[model samples]
Target: MASTTSRHQVQDAQKLYDDRAAHYDDSWHPLFAHHMVQLADLKPGDHVLDLASGTGLVTFAASMAVGQTGSVTGVDISSGMLQQARSRLENHDLENVEFHQHSITDLDTLSVLRGKEFDAIMCASVLVLLQNPGQAIKAWAVYLKAGGKFITDVTHPASQISLITFERVGRGLNRPLPFYRVPFQKPEDLQLLMEQAGLRDNHIVSLSQLEAANAGEGIMAYMTDPAHPRLDKLYTIEDADDVFDKHIDHWAAELLSRPEIKNEARKIFKEEWARLANEEGKIEEMDCVFVGIGTKVG
Candidate 1:
């Protein structure tokens, strides 16, 4: 099976999320909230910013933790997603939370926040989609007051490849996609960028709920997209392996419908996987990723 990872990168993740707005909470809120609360350390009257604040889950979380005296700003590149956030806020009548349709990479926007640096700045699932993360982090540093916390969660790529060992009809198995290990900018890379960007006091934050089974109902919703990866014209047998390799848990679960159906499908997949594990002795398992936190020093 030929690799199709390079081609898969062209997919617009932001647009995909925008289309999944209504289902966003059901699909990703759980998967995302696991490592988010490092920003909750914001003081009672602290100002906080959620970069790439998709669907406002993090902003809402921050707002709740920040108390009535505090304020939270949610910013994202997609206006559609911001609409969902705005709607969610209005529904709750949360005046402390605000939304901005802006690019996280824009330096001018940082200027707009002039002297308005926050006590914390958080950029989550958004970093993986950025074309320039170091610059983006630098912008966050500029937007944060000295000693302000900067936090973000990064999916452990290594854990992903270890989970979904893909097999092509011809190539047999274990030929996972290469991109599973390719981080847009890994934690180490991100740490370097942070230091260069004037963010200091860096540390690996707490590990959130690693397994989905440990996550809450809301977050479970976000990871519960029942749609297949649609490995059609673009994704190859190899690509499918990588697709499974990277998003195996989510996609594999999507293969089922109701609970009864999930159990039935899991029975089949589990048995098949056992054959691969026993006879071929090659099976993949799921893993955990971490959250990183630091302070803007300059």
Candidate 2:
């Protein structure tokens, strides 16, 4: 059973992913998903489960790996994301794949998966979202058969410098922002997590890809909107004018109550963003992903 806090976190995450469903694949997640599938080393006729399977990037790839004999079940809390996955599934010939609207934290309640065991269970880039990731892993391991594979990944703490810097600046201004991502600093951290979850023969590896983005644009987006990663394609700037105004108003009233301090903080924050954006006209960072694979052995 999920605690109240976990339920609320799941709900918030559901909305977050739902809002970003249109633009979720715009980033580097697609390529990472394929890499996660490769790490799984799935075989034909291997029943697989993809947790937090957003947009079916991993689910689709896993379905292909399992061929026609094996089935792949995808579970997500966001219906909007699943809609995209299902839409793509309609046009594809992979009938062995299916998506369900459910939270990974409460997988035990999913009736479709009851009494079922999987040959491999893969959760890609979603551990940071959970408040109690170790517990989730332990629960997920129960669904894996003996000698089955359990694959998941975590981002290096140094990655996503923008969000980290944002939170740091916010704290300096006496306005703490909750980033809600676990700072996994090394591969051993994830390996130990799996081992504590009753998994064995753990293997951990790091992969990095150079990623570049317009820092100024992203900083402005984060400043004006609480939801920094907005679906710009789905909602134009003009269309989101009201949302932007509301967020700004809230920040002024709640985050920075003092007018003088607020003005000074805003100036400082803008300057920091400008400095970051001025770096070669864009921010280039290494997107380091640590992949962890373990075997569910008795």
- Most lDDT-accurate candidate: 2
Please write out the lDDT profile of model 2 over residues 1-298, one tens digit for every residue: 1111113557667777888899999987887787778878899999999999989999999999999999999999998899999999999988899999998999989999999999999998788767678889999999999999999987665566445444444556656443434346567888898999999999875654432245343222122121122222222223222322334344312343345455654555555444444234543333466789999986
Off by over 4 Å in 1: 1-13, 38-40, 107-112, 162-181, 184-187, 206-285
Model 1 TM-score, all chains together: 0.65
What TM-score, computed on C-alpha atoms, does each candidate reach?
A: 0.65, 0.72
Candidate 2 at 282: error in angstroms?
Answer: 15
Q: For candidate 2, report its TM-score.
A: 0.72
Per-residue accuracy of model 1 over 148-266 as CA lDDT, tens digit each: 89987555443333233321110122222222224322457556767788778875532323334544554332232112111112222223334433444453223232343434433
At residue 91, candidate 1 shows an lDDT of 86
